[model samples]
Target chain A: METQLQLLNTQGFKHTIRRLCYELIENHNTFENSIIIGLQPRGVYLSSRIVKELKEITGLSNLVNGKLDTTFYRDDFRRRSNPLIPNQTEIDFIIEDKKVILIDDVLYTGRTIRAGLDAMQAFGRPKKVELLVLIDRRYSRHLPIQPDYVGRVVDTITSDSIKVKWDEIDGQDEVLMFTDNVEKI
Target chain B: MSALSVRHLLGIKEIQASDIDLIFSTANTFKEVINRPIKKTPSLRDTTIANLFFENSTRTKLSFELAEKRLSADVINFAASSSSVSKGETLTDTVNNILAMKVDMVVMRHPYAGAAKFLSRQVKATIINAGDGAHEHPTQALLDAFSIHEKLGSIKGCNIAIIGDILHSRVALSNIFCLQKLGANVMVCGPPTLLPKYINELGVRVETNLKKALEWCDVANMLRIQLERQDIKYFPSLREYIMLYGLNMPMLESLKKEILIMHPGPINRGVEITSEVADSHQSIILNQVENGVAVRMAVMYLLAGAKQ
Candidate 1:
């Protein structure tokens, strides 16, 4: 039997998102020249929610948002048994000389972000790049990557896994941490 | 979080249907990557790959090398003509010597069938079969199926006819296996003498008449007759074979349903197909060639990324 703990409920999740939107507005007054790219599979959900909040609060309707697939750019692609399931990467606009914000659901070993950075190079060289994540798992990063914006932080052991569920995808909005039976660290 | 299951891509027979879908999915991402400005990824950084070709090749060799470079892997080329095999060295010795230099993977093309499979067992490094004689060219089949899937929107229920020298084509064998696994209706169209003996056992239909085959198929993959592989004449003559099996504009236009034209190239332009049909809008030969790089990249990346 694994131990499960609820970290954030619907109300708390909404509050954290609204706060994060304000923080983003504080830094970026108007995202006229900035683009938001969500990492595929899970990050797109969180990024889409954030974009909706940003639009309601900041009235920024012309924001450029796209999904970035990091499947082919992953480093540990050969370290497992099952075949990879890839998602669509639909970036129709240019990232050249634009401030790019990369979004994901959770931050753990930071390998996915590293792959995202490598993948973004194929599009064009961005003037500046920033990372944003909803949940940040501290003391577990393999790479020296730090997110520019974060919703929540939690300290976890190697045997623990953090899962974020969105209402759009999972029919509920919440964050959960499971301990024991974590296969991959 | 998904990864390729096989360490070595030896042939289509060794791969599952789901694996083919995975390769196409990964190749889809790579195809987008190649179209971008940078056209390179650092996924395989610090990894070294050696391309060992025991046979003469133009497209496969160059495509594999280019795919390696695009993945940011250190690449080394070895051809039998320039290597120590000319100095009476054995295949094992040549490969072992190269492995001693610390190569992590090998993309090999050999003149004999089962060469890649044998080498995979002997070597500690990953082996990708570029082509192993008449046994299989898994990557080519993959790219062909991918191109068809891209153009036709789905592979299932599509009638694909492989026309030409079915007796001695690795491409034909691999394509039949792959297309059948993906639920496509496959047929082999060629001269009776040039057809394989046990082709029926493989669950593929054989059509001797080229006109009926072309009219029946949604896509026609014209194969080059392997003149070098034939020890004796399998057909009456080149002109007779062309008269019976050759694909021309009038014959294709008569099909009326806009059948897609394809070829595994180094094309004998006027032999298997005319230049007009090869260059027409209905032809996806160039798309197949372009998809070859992405498919090979996906294969190499998945194979190299597999666990030892």
Candidate 2:
């Protein structure tokens, strides 16, 4: 337990520094002017996590909000079994004049991340936009884009997948990289 | 939870006897939950469930979503107009992507028949079919049975009249099959065109006169005549429909015994049945709605959370 917390506190600081560095360069060194938008469920929770780390270290308290849903931005909606249901889109920070750092858990096929982008557009335009993820599967990049900061990279086969279990949602915090239930722990 | 298990639940026709019995009885556990102060449970804790509805529905979707939330699951919402459906995503692909995200289960209501069942076949997630086109609404039947079982103490020997748009109602078909299985005399009444010829094969007695069906039944379940389904000429007019078969106060008063009034709503308030009659002591429409969530939760846990 102590080790996990220690790793999170230390590595989380490193992750925060990296996240803030991109914002500083893109926004021309404006410490007081940036925001974070989290995707629904995990993505939103992840942004809040990173925001905590970033705020504690930088003491700037960058604005944080949650992207409601990207279900509507799916590439194939015509034959949808059931289309996206509208939920609460929370944005405490004004995206109109601030740099937006979109945060999520995994970025695969770039679809969900794209959906997050579309959801951000509905909120308001931002001066700059960047991406962050806990794990980059390093595959399924349908769009010609990539995350600005990544925690881990696993060269994954299409057959197997990774499942990140956090206590907030799954009753535990474990960054697992599994392939067909086989582990590389 | 296995990928090779039953696919998306579009209806109950393709289900087996054991699974059906399990669902019906599992729904019985919630009889207490339904009557409690805070009718909720934490069985689905930390689970995120999405309700993707391509069609407009109030009772079914609300009840199903409530069922998920009551089980302590996180809920996601979707609609047809602003969702990916308008963006050209195929149903299977959308389901596959969402499945990829690992949402625990999906409770869906769609206009297409066999959608829920089709989804169940492809993915490993649990499927609960809210309603599909005119094909079926299994949870509706389960809840209607649950309510009937509550009132009559048993499902046997009760005569139930399913009156309204028989042609376009999957509810009528499911009720007939399920009610008859539990020994209820199933009477289907509607316009000749609205009643299919194959209904007789299901052992349901068909009549064009709503009054005739009403006189002989213990429960009268009215069906909504979909305005969209009428474009191809199933009726003369809404005026003609209300005059001929609509349930009004006088009709309720004339019935010798108080037969239960039921409608799978978004009710056409004054068209098929009057609003006053729908809210009367004899009407179980709201009870039907209230029971839907418990019944759906029961249906879901029975299929997905059943013991191996």
Candidate 3:
């Protein structure tokens, strides 16, 4: 966090957040029956942070603790002998009637969110599903999907990539864009 | 053994040697899958596999379900509710209803050991027994054997000790058959009451003490002691049971460092084996968990594919 916060200060992200929040509040801050759901593993943490921030900003606490394993939906199962254990996607609240805002850490190929959608149908259909990703690495759009919100717009070549480090999983918070050169790192 | 040739893997021992060869070979084909740029393939596309577990199942059901989805087969899941079975419906009826859907496969777990084997003959779809009536959980044995071969380069003459719950575990029985079939020397250990007297007929030695068994083996498979269902009073108490049969840190320290440890989890942390020993560098439980999915994928593919 110290490193990321330092980097954000240097990169001027806090300044942007201050400006963006006001713009977000002024123009687009109304929803009838909305809930935020996080994708599992790390997205669970990402969505929860967003929920807390959103609640603090808008006094909304009707956030849902939902996780999607979507291991079943991945295109490559023949390769994965033991897919990630499907964790329980517990949403006691009715999903069919709500306008759900899906939250995730990184929106790469958009496959995870696509799988999350398949998992969501089991609970019930949401009226609308808007996606929020922490980082948007503009790449191949395999599934015709786009994030409704992106915290950072990072452009990169295929070999060089944006890697996210969160304290929950990586014990630090910093988004690093690096080349995947074996010799480089 | 083409790994992806299986249709549905219901049990290990139920199938012929040809099928086992098929599963192993198929698994080997996709062995490089783990290293691929994207680890996935669509094999069981559009097929539905429901994990109808009437008992708590962790590795077996999860492995099979993952294997199915990886193959592109759709997976439906159900577990024994604390209350559902008692109110209505028999295992046969439930299984039949699932089979009636003409689903590709039904991965089942029941308290009765031979239930999966019996269900296999009756169902049109394949029935892979997760575990039943202390009869056998064939896939666990297969994965264990696979892990052994992968580590030792062969299963021949490996000293294997299956400790705890032989009287109540299908894993112990399946290991006996698979290890013997794969040419490993097998030994069974636990309290006198927990082991059947005639267990030696399965071509393995039986001993009562754990240290003796631990000292004599290259691989030790610690079975989870189901504490809730021990109505017959096998051991005097849990503390006594741990003292006698539990593999603690000291016991692990006493063993040969090269020895590979294994457990079919969710482990009874401090009971059958301590957390240190279970999570120790010696443990192959996690490896077993990994291989299980591959083995099941091999099993499922072989069962469903070759006949076609």
**Candidate 2's C-alpha lDDT?**
0.71
Question: What lDDT is reached at residue A180 by model 1?
Answer: 69
Candidate 1 C-alpha RMSD relative to the actual structure: 3.1
lDDT of 1 by residue, B1-308 (tens): 35655778899988888889889988998898788777887767767999999999999988888899998899999999988899999877789999999999999999899999999888888889888988999999999999999999999999999999999999999999999999999999999999988898999989999999988999999999999899999988899988999999999888869999999897998999999999999999999989999999888877766555
Weakest 10 consecutive residues of candidate 3 chain B by summed lDDT:
B29-38
lDDT of 3 by residue, B1-308 (tens): 33332344445554555555555555654443332333454556756787888887666776777778766688888877853567797777777877777776778888875787677777777667777767878888888888777777878889999999888777888888888866789999999999988998877899998999989999999998866556778877889999999998887787765688888787988899988888888888888888787777766655554333
Displacement of residue B55 (Cα, Å) in model 3 is: 1.1
The fnat of each candidate, in order, is: 0.61, 0.00, 0.00
lDDT of 1 by residue, A78-132 (tens): 4566535567888988899999999998999999999999888878889999989
Greater-lDDT candidate between 1 and 2: 1
Q: What TM-score does candidate 3 get on C-alpha atoms?
A: 0.59
lDDT for position B228 in model 3: 58
lDDT of 3: 0.70
Write the residue-wise lDDT of candidate 3 on A68-177 in tens digits: 55644555544444323333354556678777877777788788888878756656677888887777868655788898777776654466656666666776666666
Candidate 1's C-alpha runs over 4 A off are A71-87, A139-144, A179-185
lDDT (Cα, tens digit) per residue for candidate 2, span A25-123 = 455343456677777757776777766655565576544455544543444432333322223345544577767778788777788787667656645
- Model 2 misplaced stretches (Cα beyond 4 Å): A1-185, B1-9, B16-21
